[model samples]
Target: MAMAVGVVAAPLGLSVISLVNRLQDIFSRVGSHSSIDLPQVAVVGSQSNGKSSVLEALVGRDFLPRGNDICTRRSLVLQLVQIKPSQDEFGEFLHLPGRKFHDFS
Candidate 1:
């Protein structure tokens, strides 16, 4: 499904993230068995170094679990898209398509 999102033009033109997001949408629509490799961003650092905190700040949400110890044991792929200010912000999971998660907490 195509989402009605707001597009912010970059100062110098289209950014790499915009291109990758477009490519990802195309590949996802094609199917799961497509053998195309898309560029990805990996957050690697020492343990308890605020990796999850950085991601949460970027997405402007506090959905990721945080504590004094390690809370995430599995890899997570997050797709962030810009939305219109008038529209309510929400999140969707690749495994559970069509369901809009309004609450991040």
Candidate 2:
């Protein structure tokens, strides 16, 4: 699956590496370099299929609904973020590919 996503993104001058978002988009010229926002990926599988285990391991959290016959009904956002310095404070930012930026510091 990882290889498949890499193949699909390669032809478009993109790579499948998990780079941290460094530059925040403000306003830019028409021909400026733009970022592409990858959609939030979710795991869709049957119950007891180890989906939760995978997610938990990735995020280092036990976010999977664990129980007998448990199934996830709603989508989950397992975002990776970075910390930043601010005036007399610190902040956090959501890591997206190249679209919208959200500040939940």
Candidate 3:
């Protein structure tokens, strides 16, 4: 039997903690800039190339289904918003042009 060893490294002057904090800082302002028009981020990759995995790791959730088959046939839209002053948030359901998710449930 053979064994494999791997090493993890961060870019110069940036630790893993700082990277996580940076992600937090970015997401903290998700819904605050409606008029400034910041470009959206789109993840594109072939099947099993870590697209879903990257998003799941960032948000720390297993919500995305595997991309091995046609199970995920429809498009998914996620809207992240700060529900209140605290760290509370909500993201679910789809939004239409004329319709409104008043409940935000």
Clashes of each: 0, 3, 0
lDDT score for residue 102 of model 2: 37
Ranking by lDDT: 1, 3, 2
lDDT of each: 0.75, 0.48, 0.52
Q: In order, what is each prediction's RMSD in angstroms?
A: 6.8, 13.0, 14.2
1 versus 3: better TM-score goes to? 1
Q: lDDT per residue, candidate 2, 1-105, as tens digits?
A: 457544444333222222422222231224445565644457778767887788778766454456687666555545444334553322232344444433322
Better model by lDDT: candidate 2 vs candidate 3:
3
- Per-residue CA lDDT of candidate 1, range 7-74, in tens? 65564323666777777877778766556677666787888888888888877789887777789867
Error of 2 at 89 (Å): 18
Between candidates 1 and 3, name the one with more favorable lDDT.
Answer: 1
> What's the residue-level lDDT of 60 in candidate 2?
66
Model 3 deviation from the true structure expressed as Cα RMSD, one decimal place: 14.2
lDDT of model 3 at position 85: 73
Task: Kindly report which residue stretches of model 2 are placed more than 4 angstroms away from their true locations once superposed.
Answer: 1-40, 82-105
lDDT of 3: 0.52
